[model samples]
Target: MSGPFDGLKVLELGRFIAVPVCGQLLAEGGADVIKVEDLDGDQTRHNGPIMPFEGRQYFNKNRGKRSISVRITEPEVLAAIQKLAAAADIVLANFRPGMSESLGLDYESVRAMNPRVIYGENTAYGLEGPMAPLAGMDMALQALTGLAHMTETGPEPLVNPIIDYAAAMLMAWGVSTALYHRERTGHGQRLNVALMHAAMFLENNQLTHVELLDSWRGEFVRYLKHAFADGKTWADVIEHRETLLPHKVVRAYYGFHATKDGTVGVACNARTQRLKLMSLLGIDDRWTSEPGWMPEDAHAHADYVYRQVATAFAQQPTAHWIAALEERGLPIAPVRHSDQLFFDEQVKANNFLAEVEHEVLGPIKVVAPPLRMTETPLAPRPPVSLGKNTREILAEAGLGAGQIDGLFARGAVREVHETLEDLL
Candidate 1:
């Protein structure tokens, strides 16, 4: 089937998560994505929890893209990449500061050859910042952005690298927006995405609360004091039973009681939903409407309600509770593991998973694009191996075989087996 971005060509000069993931998204949307790797290939090609024989991490983010291994520093390779950029509608890279310029792959240089190129860059910090030169990753950004501090349940903070994945998704959205703008204006622009900015944006809710609420600090102090005064650890204080907030108290209460065989994630964010949940559990009382219930103890009261609902839920298995909750129009779902997610009835019904036949790995499963468009649908394609299309991409860039072979002999271009058996 014809895809939305069928004619668009993208040259991806990136490694690891952010930029490559953006390229993958564009590729899923039907752009011809050419992943330009170094002579040794992208580092992520070696990152794994391998899937028996293939590089899982590489396959995961690189689906539907062709690979071109080239050392950007070499004149021939640089010339080849410049040609590719000239032919591309978009160019993406994630090199650190000064690296792209040193390799002659910076936006200005490429724009000189292709003025319509939508040059996108993903970096640890912004292009020009005090921390721009500092080595940054998702973990580092989380630490620097106060995400780790907020997520801390104990004395020491725990950082999750999944923040980078979220940042990558945001970056992809940014690039896609830029591409849309470029399509209308016919003026390609430089798009910059920094992990630090992405991390801060992701934590905007908490940051906004700190800025808006004058009493927020006091509330925090009170919470901490309560934690200590009650002789409870941070986890104890944060737990549903002790949250002292209506929603959390209720959520926690429902969380425990809503499970028999397995757990269920209950989302009762609205008053009507909460009411329905209460009615489903056969609870009707004046405690909800009573005034002077101690504003401070309001959360505690909610917790009591959750406890009652949970008791009802615990009486049945997860399936039974799900049916009952659905019948009452309550937002509830069973907790699903990663493997089980593939077979989820909803996922299968939506065709959220696509099967692609890999050259060496046979059949592989990939997630369909999360977006649903009536006119533009995403298609799945097999991921390319490291440098698998180097010569072909260069040739398409108008390079002759002699020039391509010279690059190969000059240690600027290389290719290897898809399985990495030769490198290993």
Candidate 2:
């Protein structure tokens, strides 16, 4: 078997991040995902006016999926898409709310043809709300949810596109789960995912008991600073000790530190780990005049402890700290950039990445699926050129060559081609 979802076929009408990511996940997991876009291609493919800078923006999210470009506004093209959707086991769409309905590509229309189709839709908010008609994205969702307020003192959205990826993961999971349910129940269902909901779920741990923060001051004030110079967030400071300690007793302890050469994150929250860290750092407990020190005052104690530990760690390089602390079971690791994963021995050893050959770009490295199924061997889908499989897809839909040619002639279908101007 190619994968668990080897026989499954999905039709994707997604652009940007969220829906495309869902299609990517499904494709990576061994599903045949067909990404349908308009004649100009996905909006993301044009990152900016500068041609050089507009490097295939669709590569990351639409990897492992076949692309089909059609003049979606044309009735003939729309009919072809509907025919494809009718044969698909799953349909993933993220059109601006009612756009799908206007185009006659909505769930109801597709489900009319294939009653067993898993119809999933991604929206900015959700169905049945005052904001349902409006458009939204990751940043908008962050602000809509309490993420902006809770993460930052004032209302400032998170810089990262966290919510978009979150929604993708959730949508993928939802589709898989829905498929499983259908297997037993012999029915398909509609799945709706919203960016706002994704952001809220991401903050499940942080948003709890947030009312207690009103009393914290001094060193606890450190959590209020979103930009901690070193890039650690406030949630990183409290971590797992959120509810265990009272506002007066809890303090910022376990987090990343900027070392001389780089950064290292340390977890020395427990008393034994604290002693272990102190001993490794060559700092005696007598420095604070408390042999078995447990700070009674959160502000003063946190300030004193962080000062000593930070100063000591800053004097040494990340490698030095790792060598001293990692083997000691002190739970310390160097803070590394994402790009560094390309060179990480552990990641490569685990086969977390794969190499795919692109016709124009040549061979390129892609992040493989993070999961491994012991029983089923899965081969990921490689990225394809826009409308690269249009003829084959239309043929599979039982269209004759003459019909396909006619559609092409009428400007309903298009195959991607790079011109000299495109290179320039």
Candidate 3:
């Protein structure tokens, strides 16, 4: 079976995460994605361990795609890229605000070349604004959007480039939507996304009502201190808190807990589930959603109740708790390291992780597409070597063998050579 985008062709002029990840997703969904790289190649080529020596982080990000190397500064290379873009159904780029226009790869120019082209552009700040021209990445955008202030990890960016990945997912979704639209209307247009925009999207709830949220969050923290420690009293902080905010205290009997051997998170939010948990732990059902309970009293009650729950959970190993909870139909699972996901029974059974044999890295596993459509199942090929399709792409763009050789010889283009693996 093939994917929904089986016949779609895409040309990618991108580096790093945002644009490339979108191309990667499209390629996985069965679009023929071809990356157009500068002569030296994408910066990610040296990002992790070098290729053909075993370890490569790039493989996870750039799979199921072919690539061609071209010097964007050369007239011949620029013409070649234009011809390729005109033939493609979609073009992806993550350039600084006006860089695309300067390189003649902008939406208006490419649309003039092929009005049906879906041009996807990702910028650091966005298309228009004072911040548009300035360079930005994952960290700077996170801090600006209040994500850093909200996180305990300080101003350092999240370990993963979550905003970059999110922006890419947005771009991919836009491309899919545009493709569907073009199928009926035969028109395509520019789609834009920004890292800052993705950051804000991620921080939606927290960013929406900043001042009120800040106050509520601060009140929650103070409640915790008063309820758990003797450092402060609820009455002392009552003046600074909204009386109604106490109703928002959603402490659940369902949450993560440290078991005797490991950690397990449970979900017993339902009344019956909570009752079952109380029965299992041999604890009395003492929680009440008493409508008029004072905020101070409610916090104290929640803390005392949770302490009992935690004490009960710590009496058993994680596995024992999981088995006990699963039998009761109270949703529960042990906390696991990410690497353990590779061998997880449910993950393997669902085939969310795919194993492929690479020409350079041998056999390996990659996260398969999370999306499932029975009729159009995706079966992505392994990631291709850098510039592996240089010759093939140029030929398909209508360059003769002589012209291709001349371009290569003049340093405007490069072709992959498998024998060069020794150089690494």
Candidate 4:
């Protein structure tokens, strides 16, 4: 069977992660994706550890796509881009807020060229807000959306670019939905996905605050404002916030515990699991087991339970706890570093990784397509280097050999064929 997007064509004007990842998703579904880049290529090409120009980050997200390198500032190059846009079924871009308008690839311009084109856009903030014009990356969005503040060692940003990945998923979903809507009614619409919005979506459960039921939320906000006004440190604010947790579940039931050898995560949320864990730990705290029995000193009782669990777990090795928890059918796992997954039996059995040959790096492993389909399975494709497919794409766009050479002569377009040392 053919893939879902076998005959679709996508034009991607993106750098870094979010929109590039969205384009990758469409390509995995068997769309023909053409990525437009400037002379230096995507920033990630220079950011990773493997090479001076083409690196791991670039390989991960730009796979299964063709690259067309051009200086869009030149009129001839802009015209060529317009021609490509006119022929595209979908156009994706994650340029800064006003950069697209300047380049004439904004939704309005692209719509004028191809009204039925599904346009997917990513921005740091939504289009119609005070912060719309401002530039933001993953860390900034995390701070703006309270993700940083909510972490355990909080008021600090997470090292991972989770917000970018979330935005990419949202963009791909929106584009797929748009494709469906177009199939039904022959209409195309623009999709705007913001990193801030994605961050909020990631915290949906915590962000849902009903005014009547969550009255404490407003009071907490007021307290934060007061704390800011009083020049209190972030540590002080977090310390104050800790005292106001609504669900005062005994701390022993959740989080990581250090065993004799390594750390293991334990989550016993259900009553039965909690009881089983308590029995194994040899504890009979009436405050936790008895229904509707509130401890007089809640903090003191919680501290005691937590210490007991911690001490008991630390007495044994991580493997011991893993075996014990699995036998009991409780939710538990040993803390394993990310590198371990590359050699993990379960990951290999599931085909979570695929090997692709790189011109410079030889064979390397990368994450496989996240989804699977019974009929139309995705095959891995190696990513091309900067401007690697420029000539072929221009030929497909109906540019003659002489015209393409002229563009190359004028420094408007380029096809890079370089050695590793030359790239460096």
Worst ten-residue run, lDDT, model 1?
240-249
Candidate 4 structure lDDT: 0.86
lDDT of 1: 0.75
Question: Which numbered prediction scores highest in lDDT against the true structure?
Answer: 4
Ranking by lDDT: 4, 3, 2, 1
> Candidate 1 has which clashing residue pairs, if any?
257-310
List candidate 2 segments past 4 Å from native: 48-54, 146-159, 210-252, 269-272, 282-297, 418-424
Q: What is the model-wide C-alpha lDDT for candidate 2?
A: 0.77
Model 2 Cα lDDT, one tens digit per residue, 245-265: 553322223888889998888
Which sections of candidate 1 miss by over 4 Å?
49-54, 146-161, 210-212, 218-250, 253-258, 282-294, 418-424
Candidate 4 lDDT over 184-285, as tens digits, reads 999999999999999999999678777766677777788987786897777777666656655466878889999999998999988899998988888766
Question: Which scores better on lDDT, 1 or 2?
Answer: 2
Candidate 3 clashes between residue pairs 3 or more apart in a chain or in different chains: none
Alpha-carbon shift of residue 36 in model 4 (angstroms): 0.4
Give one digit per residue, the lDDT tens place, for model 1 in 1-424. Answer: 6777888999998888988888888898889999988777787777774532247788878889988887777777777777888878889998877888887789998888888888888888887868778768877776677677532365444434666677678877877787789879988889888888888787876565434434445565577656777777756645633343333324542343447788788887566676676666787534543423444565656667666766777778998878887887777888877889777888899888888987766787878777777878877788866778888888998889998888888788887665534324
Question: Once model 4 is optimally superposed onto the true structure by TM-score, how far is the C-alpha of residue 296 displaced, in angstroms?
Answer: 3.4
Per residue, candidate 3 scores C-alpha lDDT tens digits across 1-424 of 8888898999998888889889989998899999987776787776775543213666777788988988877887788888988889999998766778888889999999999999998888887888878888888887777576432223345777889989999999999899889989999999999899999899886555457445577656657556536544435444335453534343447678999999888888877788888888876545533334454565566677788889989998988998898999889988888989988999988999998777765677888876778998877578766678988998898889998999988978876554335444
lDDT of 1 at 216: 46
Candidate 4 minimal-lDDT segment of 10 residues: 148-157
Best TM-score among the predictions, by candidate number: 4
Q: Indicate whether candidate 1 or candidate 3 has the larger lDDT.
A: 3
